[model samples]
Target: MKIASLLLFFVLGAVALPAAAQSVAEQQDAIVIENLRSAGSDITKPHSIDFFLYFPRKGQAKAAATEILELGYTVVELEKSPERSEWSVHATRTLVPELETMKASTRELEKLATEHGGAYDGWGTSIVK
Candidate 1:
């Protein structure tokens, strides 16, 4: 009877989770797609950027990405190597915040990276084509 109850609870929890998770994911994707479309409207715009950082140890890369996102950057993606010593954070701005807003945020990100034994490698894009 104990095993039966436990199995029932697990089945119910599992059945309820996917729908919830998928809806949440779908909403986020819709928002992100809208932001991306708006941001990339200008051909000369350089908002799409990859911000790189290097940490002293494992797990710091994820921390770095979180901090950047907290600073109000539209984080597109985060890539970490197998060693987990580095992170490449992709950010694109859909709406203009204010003059010097990004500059200030970047300085803050740099400081945060330094605190984590990493360095902010600035922002750049590889190819326009």
Candidate 2:
């Protein structure tokens, strides 16, 4: 699963391709279907989204984000926390928590963060695009 996700991400995000291989309507339908699946039993609303990861660092956010981007991820936003002590970098591109390097506690991300003077804070989301 990790390999598949990684391959897909690199293929799609490593280069500047069209917005999506599928048409806009198809993408919207895909998002809606995934939302429905998540709801399971209720009339769930749909929202567009993607893979999400968080890195915390006061100064290293942009550097860390650049690295992830090199790996084919998309950095969405970066903001200093309410206390202004830590920075939060939100990113996406693919969902592959199973990667030995990306899995929590593996330290790959945390290590990367540290190199850039930060720490891998966390990860989030299930994405379809």
Candidate 3:
């Protein structure tokens, strides 16, 4: 009975981990969207959204940039930070910053970063006039 209980716990944990992570990401997306709306930015119009990612190694950053480029994002800049000693990749894509769209893009970019031994820092954009 104890072994069975432990197995159930492990199974539940494994399933919940992804959902938990996604929930956090969705919450962040909502907050950013709300902030943008409050700032008088037109979320319905396509805006140049910038995504930030970081990798510990230059090779991983380069590989991630290639992948992001394939996803239709312009690789704006890829450089190593002298102070932080991490490779940073700034990519931009023009899209309407809807909540669902932002969430989906965040998930895809997060997955790509993870696969390339890096971290998807977050995203930002200027208020379109």
Candidate 4:
């Protein structure tokens, strides 16, 4: 009986760890999706979601933009910060704002940004009326 209990504990711990390892940005995606639903946005319908990526250099930002554009995101803007030295690329894609989909996209964007010496700063969308 003790051996069975120990096995169950390890199994549950392994299963729970992944959920607990969710990034803060992913968690915020869930909250924002819920808020959009509450605000009468049909989350199942496609919406224009904007993602922001920041880099220390303009070249890095432009490189990231080209890559994301190839990945099907529209390059909305690429500009340097007026107050700070960082450069930013604003990319948008139209997709259903489902939590899982948004989270997966966030992970991919984050990885892409990291590869380009930048960081994905998260995403936003206007409530679809």
Q: Give me the candidate number with maximum TM-score.
A: 4
* Structural similarity to truth (TM-score) of each candidate: 0.45, 0.45, 0.81, 0.87
Top of the candidates by lDDT: 4
The lDDT of model 3 is 0.90
Worst 10 residues of 2 by lDDT: 41-50
Task: Report the Cα lDDT for candidate 1.
Answer: 0.57
Model 4: what TM-score?
0.87
Which residues of candidate 3, in runs, are more than 4 Å off?
A: 1-23
How close to the true structure is residue 101 of candidate 4, measured as C-alpha lDDT? 92
> Please, what are the lDDT tens digits per residue for candidate 2 over residues 1-129?
999999999887956454354334333444544454575523232222243234455457777777867866677887776654577776664433332323322244556666777655454344422
Worst 10 residues of 4 by lDDT: 18-27
Weakest 10 consecutive residues of candidate 1 by summed lDDT: 93-102
lDDT tens digits by residue: candidate 4, 1-129? 999999999999999897789987888888889999999998989999999889999999999999999999999999997766899899999999998899999998998999999988899899887
Reference-based lDDT, residue 25, model 3: 60
- Summed backbone clashes in each candidate are 0, 0, 0, 0
Off by over 4 Å in 4: 1-8
Off by over 4 Å in 2: 1-58, 96-107, 126-129
